[model samples]
Target: MKIAVIGSKGLPPRQGGIEHYCAEVYPRMVAQGHQVDLFARSSWIHLPWYQSCRFHGVQVISLPCPGKRGLDGLISSSLGAIACLGKRYDIIHFHALGPSLFCWLPRMAASAKVVVSCHGLDWQREKWGNCSSCLIWLGEQVAIRCSDQIIVVSEALVDYFQDTYAVEAINIPNGPASYWQSDPTFSFVKLLGLEPQKYLLFLGRLVPEKCPDLLIQAFQRLTSTGWKLAIVGGQSDAPAYQMNLFKLAAANPNIIFAGELKERYLAEIVRGAGLFILPSNLEGLPLAMLEAMQEGIPVVASDIPPHRQLIGMNRGRLFHAGDLESCIQMIDWAIQHSKEMKKMAQKAQEHVQTWYGWDGITAATLRTYESLLCPPRSKVKPATELIQR
Candidate 1:
């Protein structure tokens, strides 16, 4: 099938869950003999507008972008939507709510089945201002109205759509990216003064929603000794928040801000970690946590729905969301009770490996596309019936 993808930074996934998600799923789709053309931002690809390249068999076309935080996605997605209008794509898949704003264009102008994957509720993110948040919200509404099928990354999102918009969305969770086993000598992390099982790791974008500041605050108040905090991520349009985090950790020499480690470096840090903590107030089935669990690293996350879904049932520990005391308690417990945390890590590793493989995720996505295009003739409810006015 010919597919057109929109709403990702670019291929090879420098940062962001949507980008990594595209890098994993679409390439696999290409390997399965599907033609996938991904529309990307020139800001990310650093290429001339309209220039195209191939990554692991998937064709990535760069579109003009201003490189601004919110405007970049808006302009790129608009152009991407217009570009799809001239093509004969079987499926035009949009990755996030911001880009799904233009999903209506392909639905109305092209002969394609539009699919919108709601990775998260972007409107609730603190980085986006009121105008940007409103635009994102409108995109969500537009996606509900225009798309042939909607895909959500977590059951929490499924419940969100049903309760808020009365819309039925398919739940398809994200899979972990392949991790390389780093050198046992621990050369890379040792450069940052991080020792194996002697530091806690927080891996994700340094954003307000992810609450790196909260982690820093909690880490400062911890009663533990000899253990350091290694915060690894890029500041995505949240430089001020990132700066604030740095300030919060300024007095504490134990906190190390190792900006954005990828591939082997990332693998080493994660593998060497004593614990992986994500105190996010919001999430769409965090891929970072998934990767940590897949590596058999114990986790301590906020009591958000997505985190609970991943870590509940003794898979990992959870603390009250946004509570400093709760976070401190969980971290201290996980550190002190090493044997119990190791057992939970084993269970989490097994759970993710068994349930969240990329091949299975790709296959499930393809099945969703096929069902939309060649739906069975058995007595089934129409797509319109799935949405309540």
Candidate 2:
């Protein structure tokens, strides 16, 4: 199958869950005999030594796009959809609901099957302005009515699509990257003066909806001196929000902003943490949470549906979303009962390994692709029926 993937910044996955997801999935998809061409933004294709021509085994097509937050996806996806039409691809998959706003372009101009994967409800995110939110909402509607299939990452999203749009979506949860066992040679952790099981950790984009500020606020109130809070992610088009978090955490020397750490650095950070806290008010199957679970790190997340889904599967702790008091209480309890949390983390590793295997997710994604290309001869099933599998 020839597939053109759009809606992410670029390959090598410098930022965003969707970018990381494609980096993990598409290489394997190419290895499995599918010809995949990933469309990346030109601005992200930086560093003269590092070629943007290709990544892994997949071909990379760089398109000119404004690096502006709101305009980037709209411009890139519009161009990407048109570019895919000329390529005569088998599947033109859009990674987010926002990009699916241009689904009609491919539907009319190309012979390929259109697929839209909703990572999360971007409209509900606190960062976006009113107009952008409305546009995102309209994009969701466009994806539901126009795309051949809708793929979601969590059951919460499946319920949402079914309830609101009366559209059933294929639920393929995000899988963790390669699992790494905790070890003593964590140079990054050591360099940061962090000891294993001695610091609380939070990893994700420093965005408004992620509630990193809330986490910092809760951390400040905690009386415990033994544990420090380490935040391991970069700001995603939200510098002001990031500045606000830094200001909120200014007085507390115990809280360290680790910026962005990739690969083993990221793994070691997760592995060495005493407990991982995701105080996000909104999420659609956070890969960061799954990564923590894979490393046998205990997680205390918000009571949002997606986080609840993860906690339910991994037996981790949860607090009411955006409730400072509740978040403080959960973090305190997890820290106090360290041994119990560690045991839960171990169980979470087992459960996530069993449930969220990357091979299985890749295979399922392939099956979805194949189903669109080759339907049964005897009977034609509805799009919802394809999701049921």
Candidate 3:
């Protein structure tokens, strides 16, 4: 089948969960002889119109984003969709809600199937404001209502749409990277000046919703105990909040700030960590947490539904969100019970192997697409069963 994926973020996973989803899933589709096209926005230092090119097998189409981030993400993505109007394809899957404006393409071409995967409601996020905020919220409601099919990553999201917008969704957990261990000679550690077992990790965007400050506060509680905290993620552009995090970190010498790590170094740093934590107050099945768990390090994440839905009691540990005391308690528990944490890592690895590996995710995603296309004629694939390696 011919497939077109529209999202502001492009493939090769330059950054973020949506990119990671596109990078992992589309390739698998290609290997199975399906043609896929992805729309991405490229930032040019001087020139305009950074065009599309073939990588591996997927065609990545790029357009220049007019403004920075939130504006650029919503605007450029809509432009990309507008550019792809009248395009030939069987399926047009949108990775995020902002990009669902691309569904306008299907209205122009009858045979094209349009889908919007609500990765998360960015409108509810702290980044968006009162003006564009309302616009995005309105856009999201319309996008969810009109799309041919809606895919949600977490059960909570599925219920949210069903009640709020009366939209039924196909539930597919985000893919997790397979477990791989470096032979302890990876140059990533020495380059970052980090020592294994000496530091804790917080990996994800440093944003208000993510509660990076909570992690910093928790790390501060452990300063006298000689445990260092390494916070790695991209800038959320909240200058005031970022500075606040800095001030909090500065008061504690054991905490280190390693900003914005990309693919290889990211996986290496996470895979080598003694522990990985997420302090998100709200989440829709975070890709970072899954990536860490899939990498087989022990996890102590916020007690949000998405994380709970993924790990439950056996696979990992959780603490109450936004509670610095609980965060500190979980951290100390992880440190004191390092051996139990490793056992939890083993359980997490087993869970990942059984469910969330790339193969399972890709198959589930394809099945979702096929079911949407075929509907009444389609046979339901069992939840755990998918085409295997």
Which residue pairs show collisions in model 1?
A: none
Q: Across residues 1-389, which tens digit of lDDT does each residue of candidate 3 receive?
A: 88887774665666667877887788889999999888777762223475777756988877777657576677667766666566677787777776675566565554767778888877777866777667767668667656787888888888898898777787776776543455466577656677776678898777799998988877866633756778998877677888888987786666778898765667678877888888898788887777777778889888888888776867788899888998888889888898899999888877766777778778877877788788998764755565233
What are the TM-scores, per candidate, against the unseen true structure? 0.94, 0.91, 0.90
RMSD of each: 3.9, 3.3, 2.7
Task: Count steric clashes of candidate 1.
Answer: 0
Which window of 10 residues has the lowest lDDT sum in candidate 2?
Answer: 380-389
Best by TM-score: 1
lDDT of each: 0.90, 0.84, 0.76
Winner on TM-score between 1 and 3 is 1
lDDT of 2: 0.84
lDDT of 1 by residue, 53-117 (tens): 99999999999999987889999999999999988999999999999999999988999999999
For residues 1-389, write the lDDT of model 2, one tens digit per residue. Answer: 99989898887877678987898889989898899998877777752322347788888877877678788788878888888878889999999988889998999888999999999999998888899999888899889878998999999998999998888788877787774454568777978978778999999889988999999999998867778899988756578998888899999888988998876677788888989999998898898999888888899999999988778654899999989999999899998888888788888888787778767777778788888888673333332333231
Indicate whether candidate 1 or candidate 2 has the larger TM-score. Answer: 1
Model 1's alpha-carbon lDDT is 0.90
